[model samples]
Target: MLAHHTLTGPEDAPVLVLGNALGTTTDLWSDFSLPFRLLRFDHRGHGLSPAIDGPCTIADLAGDVVELLDHLELRQVYYCGVSLGGMVGMWLAAHTDRISRLALVCTTAWVPDKGRLDERIAQLRSSGMESVADTIMSRWFTPLCPPDAVARFRAELLNVDLPTYLACVEAVREMDLRADLVKIDVPTVVIAAAQDHATPTELVRQTADELPDSELYVVGDAAHLAVVEAPRTISVILDDHFGNDLT
Candidate 1:
């Protein structure tokens, strides 16, 4: 099924597809203003998208993007993703030729702690999102993050569809993209947050190192959701990485 999406920016420019992190919608990339034609969408079970009955895998998530691209008649696009979105990006880049350049932000090749994820899932199933909201919020942004920004993301987290969120979490729990790293041959940039406890800087670095051709850039004073906590810094980093030449 095609995920709900919106396309904006100049009609004749290169296309850039923006993927959202877990628990976020297309609105996650609302802060970005770049030269390319931008496409942003909600993942399965995310904002404005339909929920699935059971668990989904990374390939299943990536398949949604493929369906969306095909529906839009887009042959190729620059892909950028965060966290869960980044995991989907890796699969798309490795399994399909639709992606030209790739940017992975605040993501990992695999879920490093499946046991912890299992515990999180169990907690969510029992007490609801409120049970894990505070913990997720802590990893999302640092104490120095703007209060309003933190509040906004926390609300977004609370608003997520529970069943869908749990299914996606299961996908992450079962994910292992380490072997897919070498297959991503396109120009790639891996962005990390210095204070991200979710996917730490070192883990992000390992992802970059494994990619055949990639560069790593770490943003300071931010956590997992750096794009929201440090919007200006992330915007600049993205523009520098994906802007300029598309030939």
Candidate 2:
């Protein structure tokens, strides 16, 4: 069974499955503060989930998500995925009938070619996460964000396991859901940090274009971690996407 963390809003509210980016935990979504039944799980090696030998593939990540859904006995869910989570969300919408709404944040439909992921994992494995975490937070932070935001991200990332960190990086390297984009048949929203160096705005726009029913929103005041740089903007985006509809 996938060891997971869950947050409650109302028992009757719609279930929202929240997944974080690589090398992070459910705490990344803690600021979301939505009024739905929020479910979060660490990838097999990242959080409370056991670090088992598994190839980091898109299918593998998607399978983990399915396993979580089955474990929770959730019939259908609204998905909120960032980076790795977004890749999994793409797969879920394409292959699963149970996803009612989909939201992709700071992610592209294709894998990142620069191998920044491999480098990141190697850094975590050898020198420890604190050093890499600093660099990552710098990349994720906007020019206007306070310096302390980076410190907070660094502190939280110190708890991640190195092997689990590598596993997720491999997953990110292998992901490419562009061909499967049009298979999505549900309401969808694509959000990008306009200043996102990790996932350029053009890539987000291209990814959004493939969806038959999707809207794109670019939050200009943020970098890769929009939830941190501008929480209220992210909140507004979610509010616009998911209003009074538990149906």
Candidate 3:
């Protein structure tokens, strides 16, 4: 089962499942302070989750999420994911009826540059995560982000297992969900970071347009991890997406 943390809310409150980005732990969701029964977990091979054999696909990750919910005896949930996590959410929402609502943050439906991912994997193999932490950090957040938080992220990056990290990287590199986006029927909200170099606003907009029922919101003054950079704004948008009961 996936390693997960759950925060209790009202007894009858709906569960809100959260997924994190690649190379990061469930701690990525720490900034979010919502009233829903918040559930956050590390991807396979990241954080407290056990590592599996390498080269798992995005669908594999999505399946793991489904298993986690099943293990907890939950059949339906409001879901939110960022970056790599967002890709998994797209897969789940398109292929399953478990997700009642979805929020995709700083994510893309298709990988824009496969070459970049190849280079990243090569670097990781040759020099490890420490070699490119700074470069990744630059795109992960804006200059205004607090140094302490950035430091914590760097620590998490370095701590990730090489095989697991590589497997996740490969999954993202090979991920192409453009065609699947049209199949998603659940209500979805796509939140894009205005200055994000990773996914970019246009990619997120394209994802929103492809989905049968979706809305796009571009948040300025933030980069890839808009949830941490603009927690209050994101929380507001999430509350709206999940409805007034979440407030």
Candidate 4:
């Protein structure tokens, strides 16, 4: 069974479920939790969730998400997924109509570097989480941040499960939802970091083009981890876009 850590907020409050990039805990969405009922937890084998042996596919992650939503008894939710989390949301939305609104941040339908992703997963599984986490975390942002922010990010990422992290890498790499994007019939928002090394501005713009009522924002002076790097800006935009006030 997949057990999810849920944030209990106002019952009438609009549901906001958060999903993080692989290798990081729900802490990746800490900034969003303050103003909403955040459902933040480890994926099947990431963060506090126990690592289990199985074929971890993007479909598996999507299945886990369904189980979590059912566990929460939420019939509808606004899904907020970053990187790997975003891919999961895309998968979920493609398969069902449970997601009322979808917000994908700093993630792409596909991983730009497939070779490095495979190598990194192998390194994480064999060499352990600590061995490759530092190297991977360094890619989280560009070289334009204060030391403290970067240091904090590094610490959190290192705590992720090695095998689960690799599984997430495959999810990001293999996902291609351009065909499915047209079928997405929800209010979708795609936020991209202007200086992001992971998902470039152009790709985000391309993703936006495929959607119907999608809004795109380029958070200034931020990198791949833009939501954390600039929470206030992200929070305001989220509140305006996906929050209950908008509905």
Candidate that scores best on lDDT: 1
lDDT of each: 0.90, 0.80, 0.88, 0.77
Model 1, 80-161: lDDT tens digits are: 9999999999999999999989999999998777888999999999999989998998898899877887788888888888
TM-score versus the correct structure, for each prediction? 0.97, 0.91, 0.96, 0.90
lDDT of 3 by residue, 52-136 (tens): 7758999999999998888889998999999999999999998999998999999988888899899999999999889989999
State in Å the error of residue 116, model 2.
Answer: 2.9
lDDT of 4: 0.77
What value does the lDDT take at residue 225 in candidate 4? 82
- The ten-residue window of minimal lDDT in model 2 covers 238-247
Worst 10 residues of 4 by lDDT: 27-36
Candidate 2 lDDT (Cα, whole model)?
0.80
Who wins the TM-score comparison? 1
Clashes per prediction?
0, 0, 0, 0
Model 1 lDDT-worst window of ten:
238-247
